[model samples]
Target: MTTRRNFLKGVGASGIAFCSCGMLDAARAQGAAPRSTPVMVKGKRIKTVDVHAHCLFHESLNLLGTEEAAKVLPPTKGVPEHFIVIEQRLKEMDAMGIDMEILSINPFWYNRERDLAAQIVKVNNEKLAELCAANPSRFGAFASLTLQVPDLAVQQLEDAVKKQGLRGAAIGASVMGQDFSDPKFHPVWAKAEELGAVLFIHPQSTPQLAQRFKGNGWLSNTIGNPLDTTIALQHLIFEGTLDRFPKLKVIAAHGGGFLPSYAARGDHACFVSPQNCNAEIQLKKKPSEYLNQLYFDAMVFTPEGLRHLAAQVGASQLMLGTDHPIPWEQHPVDHVFATDTLSDEQMAAILGGNAARLFGLKEV
Candidate 1:
């Protein structure tokens, strides 16, 4: 079987630039030495899965051609000897005690024309399937969808999961400026529900908040990403999308944004000012109660934060996640282990059990 290391070696030979030279160069500038192979923890090996991991769609970029690819992808100053070197990725995974990573590429073609978006989705899903096939032991993927065209998206989801063997669909919190709560997206949600596919909601930069997030702090990604997720989840809750698709398996990145943290406020708002909420959309449960039906990743970066998320949503709804390749949460397993709030069973679930069950993996 072709392993992740072998597949990435092929990717490197094909000249696909997965990591930007600037990022690697910056690491070298900091005098970072080559990472050594990681030591396994004593006793039984815990199967840890990282639900939030990313990679470039090299095949899709090639299909887009030079100019369009440049428009879609970030520019790099120099060609590094390797990009997403599989051996290196494995070493890091070992170091962090992550047994597997579910890869995804947040579609950047949402604003493109329907035909262009479809093409991008096709190539992306195909490439993702190929990668997962090459390394079934260590990798799985969420399919790309063209949410702008809901009908096409529904069909694409079916093809990716049924034919290509992807686990689910990875979607931005919103398509272009359109929120997922829009009625037109109900078809896509229904399809996902029917397929029992996990819908991973990873937010894009909130362009609407660009003005407030400007200058020095990288707030476009820092504050803007999580803020966008918060808004998206709120819309799903308040606008009745969640109520409509009650069985939808949605996984919210960054600990379900800020909603899980301040969910009581939503309940209070609904109680104090019924007139403020949509009277037409009556929910069966309180807004906060709906949180139990949703899932979150342990990427909050603090023990207290993860504990709060677990307390609100329950550990059963929380899973392991590291926004890998971006250098966040480098010690995800250790982070979960260090959190005092979780019991041994809760820690086991967050580390890998929940993810294994959700993704239908039998390895654990």
Candidate 2:
């Protein structure tokens, strides 16, 4: 009963529908296809590892109230305000193309009051352990400690590592106005070395310097933090701490705090004249040798800087770092990618490979 034109129209519609279905089927087949993954930059391939990233909890402040937190460091509201949750951090990591992030919290590194410090340590470490528990592959923790109590610090280090499966311990550059190299910390260092732990030394605003530079506006982080690190590193190197514990993995955050750039002076001073340097430790090799042995994060904020870091310390020693949730959200991997000199292999090493080896992560 239908006209020839109607029949032709129906046929045409059916053909169009058939083609749509066929296209979808083709797409589904393609989507299901397994292809070789090539980590290429401009047609070259490489792997990457992000060794330094910070993850904090909103509940931390609740554990340490405003007054208590301020007494410890600087007070900030903690209850409802989560700085950056692990889930969001993981999502951000995906967007940033970071293969892995070595996580630590440097906020409560040095608090003299034993009880408060211990409490904060418990809260942070438990959170870190839980986070790592929830996502084993995606997270590794650097356990917090109450460094004011060296014995307690050692205890926490053992518990955090053996019990909680932590990778290392994060300590402040200076603990209670005293450098970490002081003999008081020998037990802590000995334990760390015994465990083959990587001690991540982060800088905090010195209280004395805070009072001195109150009006100059350079007190908080600008000059204070780097200065703290520089002094801490010098003490560690010159005071014979590194010599005492040769196997200890002491990771100086912030590009070794001007040590790499100014290493020649120390070497020249140590070699050219003995008394010029006051370090008690007798040195066999040049100071630069120790520098080479120590690992540095690529948070220099530029490709040129990263290239120089690689040149100073071989690409194998360079690790990716993104001090995220800070004012600068720079991704160190991106800087490495922008660099023209690094081959794919070198890039891979700097990005994530070296860190994997350092943290004992299985091959990704």
Candidate 3:
């Protein structure tokens, strides 16, 4: 039996860069990792879809001109990736037992001026659409947009989904420190709901907690990332953004961050301190109940973790996610299968059924 140690060994040996974290510790593919164990449920082979894969555009890399490319780009910037992306990415997906990946580029352009950010968004959205177009069966993408300019973002979201054949939009937990609950983003949310597009929330970690997070253990990501998503989701609930756009489909990465782990506290917040929550914005549902409306990737790292998440949120809301190339949850399909608490149908849904339905992916 291949232990989790062996699974980590394969990814660590051949893992690509962590491009979004502003650092990169990438290595070339260390030969081919073994192909993944096939997922069989009820004597049928189930398709596995990885919904949290990432990538960046080479054309847009040079466009972050305010800083030197070395600092602006990931550590492995000019070294790998751009040279052999498709071939390499497909192989990794295959080894991870992923039949298709829903690609997204994190919001590095979130802080740029409107015009420059627009330029970067164009490059990324176009490239992502093109790549997915070329690899129809293996890839689909969530478009990048300039959220700082919500008007432009709405139009961009419309274009990406309607014209480009993209699945949805990828956004940061917050834009330049501005939370999504702010009314300024309502137009984008409205457009997303109208178009039936999913908004993927990927965290850049919490800049506000940088001081406390400075020591060992990559705390910025370990604690900060999940915290950021928790904060983002709370804001959306507390401020009634989710209520306003009730149909908005959201996928929160890293297992919807720390929200699922400690959600009953949210349900009790208003009861404990009515003064802390805004009186003008009344929530339609309990904060924890809103979790049922949201979707999450299974990157929680344990069968119990996934099991707990499925218990908190419905099993119907769970989807497989590998956070590919980052080496997080490399054996994703196996991970779902390992969760003994889930029935065969529940495991099938998390492995791929949920994502394939959400993204409108046709079957083999």
Candidate 4:
């Protein structure tokens, strides 16, 4: 019954400040928004496990073995060249103090053409496998899925994980305007939960809202992305997707897009009207209990927000996510260490310990 507009009203200016003040200060201090060199963490330096870094591949050089495939992809943001190699990525990771990066392509580049999307996922997975083969310890992959075809997605997921040895899967907040919580996606969620796989849900800018802000270009990526995440989470919670697939290990990016801050309102609304939802799953606990079950990334970009997210989700469920290749957000490790509220152990967990546990990353 609660609309998206009313939900966003709760996460106003204070919420934005809570999530982004520290990085804003760092950028403001620099005069120009400059990238900071990754600092060495004192005491026992946490092995940084960045869950949201990205990469581009030579689609021409892919198994498809045609230059046209590369041409289909719109140009990536950070890496301008046609081919972004693994070693160059390593240098950037080193600069950012990221010991390991979970690589996946941004979903915006996806063409809804199902066959092409399938080919793209195959090529991307191959590229990732090649990288991990070269530098096994330094990288893990969040395999792309051709969600346009759920059965194909399941097949690719099996290949990516069982055959290619990738860590898990990465998905967009929505597929073709349909939310992940839609009944059509039950098979996808069931497969992911069955594998005990980590599903890293990333936000792509909303397609529908793009026309609304045609002149103000910033609205799509800046506002629409978080909005997309917020909408997706709302659908998952209110529609009872989380209740049905309780075992799904969902890792929501952008600190769950202000979901923790708005937990009270969501639970209250759900309590007042149960028939509004689709799935019949009920819980003795509040909606906050469901949030605690879901994992979040430490890309919220401020000490206060990080403290709040840690308090909300618990340190064990918080992993590092750098919106890498997107220069706007703060670097993951720096943001985690900057938080005074997190003790040494908590900081370590956010940086890498939690990720290690989640992905079963062997400690170095």
Clashes of each: 0, 5, 0, 0
Q: Summing lDDT over every window of 10 consecutive residues in candidate 2, give the lowest-scoring window.
A: 15-24
RMSD of every prediction: 7.8, 12.7, 5.6, 8.7
RMSD in Å for candidate 1, one decimal? 7.8
Query: For residues 1-364, what per-residue lDDT tens digits would candidate 3 score against the true structure?
Result: 2333443454455451122111222322433234443545555666778889877666887887646445644443233543327877776666567888898887888888999899999988888888988999888999999999999999999999999999999999999799998999999999999999999999988998899999888889889989999999989988899999999999999999989989999889878998987888778888899999999999998988988999999999989887666666655765775677888788778878888788887644
Best by TM-score: 3
Q: What is the C-alpha lDDT of each candidate?
A: 0.78, 0.67, 0.80, 0.72
Report the C-alpha lDDT of model 2 over 1-364, residue by residue, as the tens digit.
Answer: 2222332344334431111111234434644211112233333333445556665654665567767655443333231213556665665565455645667788564643777778778888888888888888777879988888889999999999989988889878887788888899999999998998888877886667777767765556656766677788777777777888888886667666667777777767766786776666677566667777778777777667777877876887777776553423343444565676777677767766777788888756
118-141 per-residue lDDT for model 1 (tens digits): 988898888888878988888889
lDDT value, residue 323 of candidate 3? 66
Candidate with best lDDT: 3
Candidates' TM-scores? 0.85, 0.80, 0.88, 0.82
Candidate 4's error at 86, in angstroms?
Answer: 2.8
Model 4, span 1-364: residue lDDT tens: 1122331243242231112222446555754222222322333445678888776676623534456545545444555522556666666666566778888776633445777677778888898898888888888888889887888889888888899999889899998688887787888888888888899888887888888756755777667777888888878876678888888988888888868877778767755786775455665467677888888888777778988888887988898887666554545555665676777777767778888888998744
Between which residue pairs do clashes occur in model 3?
none
